[model samples]
Target: MKNLICLTMLFAICQRTVGQQVELPKATFAMHTGFLFGVWGNYEARLGQRTVFLTEAGFSFQSMAVFTNEGKEDVITPVLLVGPRRYFKSKISKKKSGSARITRGFLGAHIKFKPNSFFLDSDGLYGYANHLGVFPNIGMKKTMGERFVMELALGVGYAHYFAKQEGWPENIDRPTVDLRIRFGFNL
Candidate 1:
């Protein structure tokens, strides 16, 4: 009888431990490859079950062809961003604990601090330009297992750039677009 009781307790403890890891992620390591910001990455931390916050940093390489004497030049810049993301999960889902994974879709947003680019101006001089932009985004996330999730989102926002050198057109601002896809794992 004692052996039977011990086995039953062990079984119940095992079940609870197994159920603990199947739900919401507290944090994630994320990667970003986008049109506006080039290739960048970030870390996301969940503020709640359906909401998370993120920050990004990476590099972008740009090459420009010149009609003048300089044939081609490459400019590499560092990129950084910070923002929050909120997820809206689907209702119809696989259920084991009578609870579903809230990972089907999400509506999110971000503010990206643009990387600087170097360009050879008409005066035959290289100049630097940097921008900061923010946008609201929408995305979808899927969890393959206990730790991995994939996401994609689209956003549009306004941006402005600052140039360091004199006569470099310091105040340059425009509308920007963001299309991003992320593959991440919970931490």
Candidate 2:
């Protein structure tokens, strides 16, 4: 009788443990490669089951090409991005494996700050330009294996320039576009 009771308790505990759902990752660290900022480190934290808050800080090696006329200049500028992203459930299914690839679509409204681009002007004057912008973006994040993740995003928005150089306009109606690809691992 004692052996039967022991076996039953062991079976019940094993069933309970095996039946629990897998928990989602709560934090991730990523790397970004894109148009404006060449390479950056990103951190994202889950705020809810389908929402995450992200922040990134990095250097832009191509800031001169985007902001100034010095296309061949090697300039490095500071870049910062902050935003909250909401993920939508995906409906895609797979027939071969009987399990779908985990892909989540996300929408985000991000604020970007690029400060202090030092460039030599056409008139031999050194100047600095600052950019502040808002971008509404749409993206898809795909999770692979246990910790690997990849994301792609596109955005179009407006940028306001603050310049301290002659012939450089402080235009607030400038249009900007962004495309980003990121690879990450859950931490």
Reference-based lDDT, each prediction: 0.59, 0.66
Off by over 4 Å in 1: 1-23, 31-39, 61-76, 91-102, 115-127, 164-166, 184-187
Top-lDDT candidate index: 2
Residue 58 in candidate 2 has what lDDT?
80
TM-score of each: 0.60, 0.65
lDDT of each residue in 1-187, candidate 1, tens digit only? 6534653454344334321222345767765454443556678788875557888788765554322254666655566788776555453355676644445555555678755554434454454556678766666777655566566777777777664433453466678777666655554
TM-score of 2: 0.65
Over 50-152, each residue of candidate 2 has an lDDT whose tens digit, in order, gives 6689899886665344445754455666789998876654534355756445677667778999766544434453445568888777788877655666789
Residue 79's lDDT in candidate 1: 66
Backbone Cα, N, C clashes tallied per candidate: 0, 0
Candidate with the greatest TM-score versus the true structure = 2
